[model samples]
Each structure stands twice: as structure tokens, then as C-alpha cells.
Target: MLTEARLVAVVVTSAMAGAAPPGVDDDAFLAAMAEDTYELVAGLDSVTPVLVTSMPGMEEIVWPGTPVVEIPDLSGAALVRAAFAALPYGEQAVLLSGDAPDLPALLIGKLFRALGRARLAVCPAADGGAVAIAAHLPFPDWAEVGFDDHDPVGALRASAPAPRTVATGPGWHRLRVPGDIARLDPGLEGWDGTRALLSG
Candidate 1:
């Protein structure tokens, strides 16, 4: 009896839900973010989507059957640690920023593929942060590096004792402020939740 190894993708939505750019409705914005995160991860059939947040009632946002891990500490590595603990069944984990709704599915697929060759992989954000990170179980120290500020990805790479074990995947846009809207491509079909709300 052989069971498939689980690969969990933990989507952190607290950041997106807490901050909405000017002129956007808060509820609509959060709904779009939640919808987009599920939609983006849904495109990757091999991975299971999990919601990790300190905020209560977030479970209602993700698709049914999706697990939610509510942690009191979401700072830096603690966030990853909680996710790692929540999904003990997962042999591998990918931390996804709930904000990158428009990120292509292929880029996320690339992160998992990159992890195949390395212990750690990061999908760099255009803002110098990270949109997603892939790491095998028994997490590496570099995985603890804070994914905040302007250069968390750079910091993660530098923290790696073995640079070769850290891999980089295709970069993508991570929406934060209103100006970030410029990076969104009009042709992308999957981020409909976000695009529809912002279309007006």
C-alpha cells in the first residue's frame, strides 16, 4: 500500500485582507484575493491548498476540503513553522503570498520543479520580496529568513549555508499598493476575480 507524498501549498491571506488599496471595497478586495489564491493554486493539481492565517473565519474563503491553520504567530519563519506543523502529512511545502493573485500557474509549477533539484526554491517577486517558496520537509535554515521588506529573497539566498541548495524560480508580480496595478497583464485569464473587481 503506497500513498503519494503530499505537497502542501500554504496561502497566507492575512496580509492581503488587512490592506486594500485606495478606492477598492474591503470585502470585495478580500474576496478577490481569496478567490484568486484558490484559483491560482487550483491550477496545480498535484499540490493541496491550505489556508494559514491568524484571522478568524478565513476558512469560509477557500474551497471546501481545504485545511486552515490559524496561528497566533505569522512573523518570518514562525509562519512557515506553523504551516509545517499543521500539515504533518506533507512531504514538501510551498509558501504562497495570498496577494499574488495574478501570478501564472506555470511559475508556481516551476517552483516545485526547482525544488526537485534543490532543498529550497523561491519565486522572486518583482518588488525584491518573494511570492512563493518551495522547500522539502525537515525545513532548511534559509527557509526561516524573513519574507518581508524590500529584499527578503536576497536575504534568504544569503542565509543559505550552501548557496547551491537554494534555487530561484521565475519571478512574478506581487501586488501591494495601488501603483502595482500597472504590472497586471490584461490578457491573464485566471485572475478573473481580481481583474473583474478592478476593471471598473
Candidate 2:
């Protein structure tokens, strides 16, 4: 239940947990991704971008004017459940994986738009996992669903109650392994920070 139509982009800034792309360490990779994701949504008039994380010292890396929400490093399904639980009831929100550094603004916009109708909308990653999950504030009890799986879209859909409608958005690439970096488009409007780091 949302207080209004306000859209909030909750970028999950969890530290990079696995392998990073070439020439980029975990910190550099995570920072680049964070910057890319934040900038892509920051320009959106209808959306408010906030960095959500359990990582310590996150404020130091955050953009000066941006807001941050700190949650316990609950580890696993509980972490995301807490992230959404920590959100204000008034904000209709989308939870994005920080690893999808080059995810486009258009897709981010589409998720918010889809939330206008469906109770839940998820953008599946071209690889295995999902890059984004969107829903109204006080997110449904499905936070733990499909999260542990390599391919979560099916589990995410199956876990929803019949009363709630789940929508699937366009699939995108997430930089999970070094190879995923190749999927980043040089012509894309966003991800400049990631591009710079990769090119360096």
C-alpha cells in the first residue's frame, strides 16, 4: 500500500561478492556500478534515487546530495527483506542489484511504469539472475523468493499469490563475471562511470 504515486529507485549497493570485470578490483567495480546506477535514475523527475546497503563506510562513496539507507548485513534473503522493510511506506520502489552497472534508464523507467498496474515487476538478467525487482512499499512477503537461485524469474513468479499480478520487464545484462562486461554497450547514454573505469 503506497501513500502516493512517488517512485523510489532503491539501488542495492552491496559490496561485490564474486568475480569482477577485467582491470577492476571489487571496490572500483562496485563504485563504478553504483555511480552508473545512481546517475541513470537521478535525472528522472518522477523518481527519487537512494543507495541502500549494509556495507560500512558507504556514505564516503555516495554522491554528496544522495540519500542512503543502511540495513544490517542480514546475509541472503533476509538482507533484501530488510532493505525493502526499511523503506518509507509512501514510496513505491524498485530494488536494483548494484552489479548491473550498465543497466539503462529506460528500463528503470519501465519498471516504475509497470508498477502502476502489476503488484510486482522483475527484470530478468540476460545471464542467470534478475537485475531488478519492483513493487509498492511494504513489499509483499515474497522477498525471500527465488533469490537463492541462479535463475530467479520462475521462482519469483511462482512464489506470488494468485491475487497478486507479477509482470516481467525487459531482460538486461549484469556484470556478474568478467565476461559480462563485454555485454556493456559503448553507445549507451548511462554507465559513463563504469565506462571510464573499464577503459582506464
Model number with the top lDDT: 1
Considering only N, C-alpha and C atoms within 3 Å, which residue pairs clash in candidate 1? Answer: none
**Tens digits of lDDT, candidate 1, 30-57:** 7677678777786667777777777666
| Residues 1-200, model 2: lDDT tens digits | 33235555444545453536655688767777776776776676766667787766666655686668887766455766777777654557887877776677788778877888888778888756677878776788764543334656566667777534688789897776677778888887778878887788
Which structure among the candidates has the greatest TM-score?
A: 1
Off by over 4 Å in 1: 1-4
- The local distance difference test score of model 2 is 0.69
Off by over 4 Å in 2: 1-5, 13-19, 146-148
**Ten contiguous residues minimizing lDDT sum, candidate 2:** 1-10
